[model samples]
Target: MCRTTVANPMMNEPWQRLPALSLKQLQYFVTLAQLRHFTDTASRLAISQPALSSALRQIETVLGVSWSTVPLRRSL
Candidate 1:
């Protein structure tokens, strides 16, 4: 006999409250947030550094806050 366990839908509910982030923006933010280096973040995002910068700028404009002002904890 085989058994399967499904994650409780409620356990994943927190994700529902998050604003939708485009794949490009999400990748860019994740890279930038992890590295805190624009150049590196751009490289990791597979876009021109300028493009990456512009994307982040657009995100800031849309969200009305600079990413620098946001709190992010470093992963140990």
Candidate 2:
């Protein structure tokens, strides 16, 4: 029996060995992106404002990218 393995650069990377990100972090990131307001997103998510900010910062640090510089969609 032969098992052909697919290669994923992200999966092979050293950083990829790290644990998965929390669902809460992803939720905060998405909410912040859609609302563009920390306070509003925090309230909507029922999490504290500082917690929302920390979640975003932690993700950005782990991913080595800034969400502020990333444009997900065109705004009016």
Candidate 3:
């Protein structure tokens, strides 16, 4: 019996250029989303609030998405 392997077509597309996201950055995003509080998220991640904010900004810039500016239920 012979087996065939399939390749992802999208990977060869020229327009598939996408920015990379770090694992740490992704973790920060998920934690912030779940906690809904910058201070709390920072504390949970063992980082300063400003550091967390900066990391989030970097992620936003890389993905070209605005999340911090979005209106959401959060506590300072």
Candidate 4:
């Protein structure tokens, strides 16, 4: 008999090109991605809209990618 454990993919940094990302920032990113609504995500995260935006910005800074704009909505 053998026992095996699967490692967490996110915890493994296969590449060292980008800076390390914090779990909080990733949470903000993932939450916003899932909800696609800043107000709702902010409410779910129990943080102000501005705080959510800030966390997202921090994530972008760490990854050096423009995940999305901070406006949170399109003026269509």
Backbone clash count for every predicted candidate, in the order shown: 0, 0, 0, 0
Q: What C-alpha root-mean-square deviation, in Å, does candidate 1 show against the real structure?
A: 9.4
What does the lDDT read for residue 18 in candidate 3? 70
Candidate 1, residue 20: Cα displacement in angstroms equals 3.1
lDDT of 2 by residue, 1-76 (tens): 9999988767788766875678887787778788877788989999888877788889988778897788755688
Query: What lDDT would each prediction earn against the true structure?
Result: 0.78, 0.80, 0.86, 0.79
Determine which window of 10 residues in candidate 3 has minimal summed lDDT: 67-76
lDDT for each residue of candidate 3 in 1-76, tens digit (9 for 90 to 100): 9999899998988657778888999899889888878899999999999999899889989989898576556556
TM-score of 1: 0.60
lDDT for 52 (candidate 3): 91
List the candidate 1 regions with Cα displacement exceeding 4 Å.
1-18, 68-76
What does the lDDT read for residue 59 in candidate 2?
94
Q: List ranges where model 3 is wrong by over 4 Å.
A: 1-18, 74-76
Task: Give the Å shift of residue 16 in candidate 2.
Answer: 7.7
Error of 4 at 30 (Å): 1.0
How does each model score on TM-score?
Answer: 0.60, 0.59, 0.69, 0.62
| Order of models, best lDDT first | 3, 2, 4, 1
Q: Write the per-residue lDDT of candidate 4 for residues 1-76, one digit (tens) a residue.
A: 9999997777666664457778887788888877879899999999999988788778777777775545556578
Clash pairs (backbone) in predicted model 2? none
